[model samples]
Target: MAGSRVLFFEHTLSIKGFDKALEALDWMKEEMCKEKGFSRHDGGDYYDHLVATAQDLLDVGIKDEDIIIACLLHDSVEDVEGITVKMVAGRFGENVAHMVDLVTKKPGVDYKVGDNLKRYLEAISKHPGASLIKTADRIHNFGTLKNATPEKKLRQALETEKYFIPFFKTCRGAHPRYAKYFFRAKTTIEPHLWEIKEHYEEIEQLRDQLRKQERTA
Candidate 1:
């Protein structure tokens, strides 16, 4: 799996019923597949990430209907041109829509850079359920971080360390029911950061060695 062009998340467990949530998943899968602009960077289908994220939630024993639906559609408002918070509300109810909106980055702002990242994390902290969904999203994202450029992998791992680690810690306090799951997520993600950072360091070392050889020649 590590050598494959795309990494797949495999889980045998699935939740049944919740037809509306499944309906929302179908809707998101269709939209994500058709949208030429959306990029997964992991060389996998966008819908796979959504299902993996929702599965992460279920793995941690979070079976809330709205949160699950939010996990399925969290990126729709941001990535799909025609999808709106209002449209999501009309179809899946306000709770799902609201959580999705809360996690969606603001328009024209690069949520991964500068103060935008901080503000995005802060906004998500206001809603515990939204925070959990975001955490699950990150866990799945980083867990499958195989095909991205080394720079992206390093920067994102650093961001997760500096911002998301403490954010998860704080969430543990406010969301007692999810505390253990948050801890598990934190542990799961931290090791990836270390691995990426180490890989980056090794690359820099090789670059330095090559530069030295060129200079001596």
Candidate 2:
């Protein structure tokens, strides 16, 4: 079972330039560990999540080594204190850092969470490479959202359906073959979201029943 699982994962990463991609993944694991989210991100194994995103990029024929490496480090500059674009450029080369910069949300911007999200939605047009990474990131986020709180699940699911789904559509236009599977894979999440939505209604109903019982008592 373990071997089969490894093969399943390996096949996905073997799209092209497998060795380099895998090495970049290793670098990501090492560098991401330096970020606080490495151990603390709500989703266990955020490093693995980025690896999955990198594989998604590879599967989409993103053979540009810089872009692949950028995919691996997409969150580092944002999540890691003192990890600036210049730092990334110094170490990873300008092209790789540029891609990471394109995706990293600017800090100190007072945009609300929803507004920041909106910024990403609007920014992707000017940065197609960043958009590719964002699409892959969103795929993993919504795909694994069962682990999120029901409220979180609903909020993220709605945001994804509203903003990220269209982002996926744009990416599909560029890489139709691979992007098709991304949306196909997300078919499961809709039901997952519905399930969470029902949980909310059920809780409200039970709360109402409790209030009526208390009033009677």
Candidate 3:
């Protein structure tokens, strides 16, 4: 008994602390508002985008407060130059920061985007919460991909089918209720999937132009 001095543990519930998580969501939105999304004023509404991603998580049965917090902060580190993973960890707790950090792509460098994206996808696949957030991120992004250049949209669609749909399926398997909710959002976007290929000719021309420019540089 003397040797068994002390051992204690605590359990936390999302339902209990989720209100605080919403407050962090507001903070993340404000930071993102000062930044651009996929592009400038055209991507004018990051707040809406972040909210939509969060809503997707909610719909998919991800009620963990930290995961929800990660959803709100996902893009901030990737898109906003000054923001750092440490800052998020400091504010939201390391668990939330680590999840967000897992999904945040590193700042641009000379390396190939394709290779980086493959690595990014691999990392996301390892974490259930990260996978869930990314799937929501892609689902919302697909809805808005029309705002991207034809080439960009086509590339994204191909990648989504190649990589993301599989990850979404994994997320779907994580919970019994998730497949239904995830597919409900998927149905809304399935109607638009055909359009991603509509501008192949234009996209190819744009790609040729960019390739020529790259070669010249």
lDDT of each: 0.80, 0.69, 0.68
For model 1, the run of ten residues with the poorest summed lDDT = 2-11
For model 2, the run of ten residues with the poorest summed lDDT: 1-10
Cα misplacement distance, residue 150 of candidate 1 (Å): 1.7
lDDT of 1 by residue, 1-217 (tens): 3212112222122235667776776686578862664547866568777877877786677768788889889999998898999999999899989999999987888866758888888788778789999998889888877888777888889989989998898788878888898898889998888988898889899999999999999
Question: lDDT of model 1 at residue 82?
Answer: 89
By TM-score, the best candidate is 1
Listed in order, each prediction's TM-score against the native is 0.87, 0.74, 0.71
- At residue 199, candidate 3 shows an lDDT of 58
User: Which regions of candidate 3 fall more than 4 Å away from where they truly are?
Assistant: 1-17, 34-43, 108-112, 170-191, 198-217
Candidate 3 per-residue C-alpha lDDT over 1-217 given as tens digits, one digit per residue, 9 for 90 to 100? 2112111000122345576566665675567663544433354646566666776666556768788778878888888778898989888888988889889877664223566676787778677778778778877888877567766777777776666666566556664355665465456555566566655766779999999999999
| Model 1 regions lying over 4 Å from their true place | 1-15, 34-39
Residue 29 miss distance in model 1 (angstroms) = 2.1
Candidate 2 similarity to native, TM-score: 0.74
